[model samples]
Target: MGTIKRDKGLDNTLKVMKQGYLYITNQRKRLGSENIFETRALGGKKIIVISGKDAAELFYDNDKIERSGTLPKRVVNTLFGKGAIHTTTGKKHIDRKALFMSLMTEGNLKHLRELTRNHWYMNTQKMEQMDQINIYRESIVQLTKIGTKWAGVQAPEEKIEEIATDMDVMIDSFKGLGGKFKGYKASVDARKRVEDWLEDQIIQTRKGKIFPPEGTALYEFAHWEDYKGNPMDSRLCAIDLMNTFRPLIAINRFVSFGLLAMHEHPITREKIKSDDDYAYMFSQEVRRFYPFVPFLPAKAKTDIQFEGHPIEKDTMIALDIYGTMHREDVFENPDDFYPERFKDWDGSPFDLIPQGGGDYYTNHRCAGEWMTIIIMEETMKYFAERVTYDVPEQDLTVDLNSIPGYVKSGFIIENLREVV
Candidate 1:
């Protein structure tokens, strides 16, 4: 029955923008509290910021909070798309989620891994003939090809660069104010272009003009039905298909970080090469250590009490994903990059929520999480065992203020060659 601690700010929007991933963690420390606090941002909207495993569990409890009407329109438009699975709740959410989870089966994951390996091999061969290669830029193209093909969408070879650029702009614009309008425009244009393409594919599939492999994402989603058994709207189906395509490309951020990790922690290079188990652990640590998603937003579904503080209905709640992963109580020496920590890890969903926490089938966790890990693991192995590149002197510093901060120089490298 204690009063919830509060920050003395009229609105924290600017502060949050300035502090970035450190915003919530810094607030908890400044207030001398471990978990819950209240602040205002987003035009005086009250936000309840919560961190740690217990808080994450409560934040994701569908009975307590829901995602519908929670995210800003800008986010919905630019990042998730209108009518996306991210905007649904209850039974509708479950149904839409199943459509996504269906694509993550062991067989499909193996297929994706094989596709990733082949694309990486081909890209490296091309890079071997170049003066320098940017891992981030190259990853976007390679993954766009892999993701679209694996998802059963066929982007013409001539259009891959244009499609990849649009996807990149949409992702980059969601986080900062500097280019938000541009991001929104890019999102609108990209959606129109991609949806038009996907709708045509769906029409072709229906008319038997194009044959997407059975069980592939495009085929399943294009033909998916709603909870009530009606077919999904064409635009929504397109959104869901991009959901698969975009996240796979977004793994480029992690690929950049993975290379940075290999550069900084040279021992990991050998460990990842020699042992598959170590590679898995290393991938987990990279996700836990690096900052990708800052927080997840939901709204209080009803009046609720958390840790004795009353939360009014419609209050915005942000589960601090970054802070939770860096909590000292949950992770010993939370700041260090240590892959060995996961060797005996108990695999708690809430504690390691880089994507999200809870059952993948029923909750708001990212559906493509397994695929992200696989891509990273495969990329890590390739960097460690297959490539011999020199990390030239460049700015490797990461800006915490950026929503998806990247290595400043994009982790420049030279003398690229296969480790024969």
Candidate 2:
């Protein structure tokens, strides 16, 4: 075994900042190393960036790496929330994760899909009255409504826009420096208000002041018990509830990419309209081809070695999610957008993780992934068959340097019309 190659620099923090999603893969190509390399980032913190299927498998091993203390403090405060499930491990993680997994049943998924389709129809009707709309912006508002309602949280009709904007700002905070401070502020403020509201609901549910449908996420999470058979911390319960809500709204990014794919590959639109299976394929391709989550961070739980590289206990490691999905060996012509490639996909957990890899129930994989797919498939079918809108000439380039990238023009559309 050989020592892992290291990039020479005082620190690669600026390199990572400048390169964003391309940082790791670019270094791999320049150094000609076998999918593992070391660099310093974020104020000179030693980070081992790893890619490829086997590396991902190793990275997710619970005994080797742990999620706690891996994410940036700012990230936890802004995006994930303090005490969120993303920060737990062992039996605590399993018990908390079960609350989320329980809400992912077939009946619940069908209910979410119905809510999504209904919201889309209402939003499209409103859009038809206007001259143009940004699908990315519209999706945030629409999906927020669907997410809040389906999760059994009640938002007044008037406050949905405010709540939606806060969620959007929280996600946007993880990206560029220009908006980072403002995004952080928004996240802090939003968490306080949202958590306060959710705590009230949890209290109401516990006291019978309000009854969320028994099987709904709101009620389940409100009443969920921890490993000690005590009710979860009210604030933590609220944070976990937002975990279910926020990611659904964040699917707007993928929805925007899905629209871009259809516009670029017009032929696929007809196939998407005619074949349900094809729509699912198109959704998978969009996830693979786009840049959403760039990387996932974890910490070495104990001194360990991978491919002869010694990782000290508590050393930070980054799994290159973008690089793995685009690895040439794993994905043929990986840069090209091709939906048909998924027709015979082998379903390897590590190969195609736009979300985190490994078993959802036991690992740190995004619990809301199935709900994301259901929403995307429904959105594709809606755009293909039930709605018609013109994609006006606009900048459609996706900036690789942007974390959670978006179409440059947010996928503008005009002259919206309902097919019915």
- Local accuracy of candidate 2 as per-residue lDDT tens digits, 305-395: 8877788999889899998989898899999999999999988888889989998988999898889888999898898999898988899
The models' CA-based lDDT, in order, is 0.86, 0.87
* Residue-by-residue lDDT tens digits, candidate 1, 367-416: 99899889888888887888899888888988887677788887777788
| Candidate 2 lowest-lDDT run of ten | 175-184
Model 2 earns a TM-score of 0.97
The runs of at least 3 residues in candidate 2 whose Cα sits more than 4 Å from the true structure, single-residue gaps closed, are: 176-180
Task: In candidate 1, list every pair of residues with a backbone clash.
Answer: none
Please give the lDDT score at residue 177 for candidate 2: 32
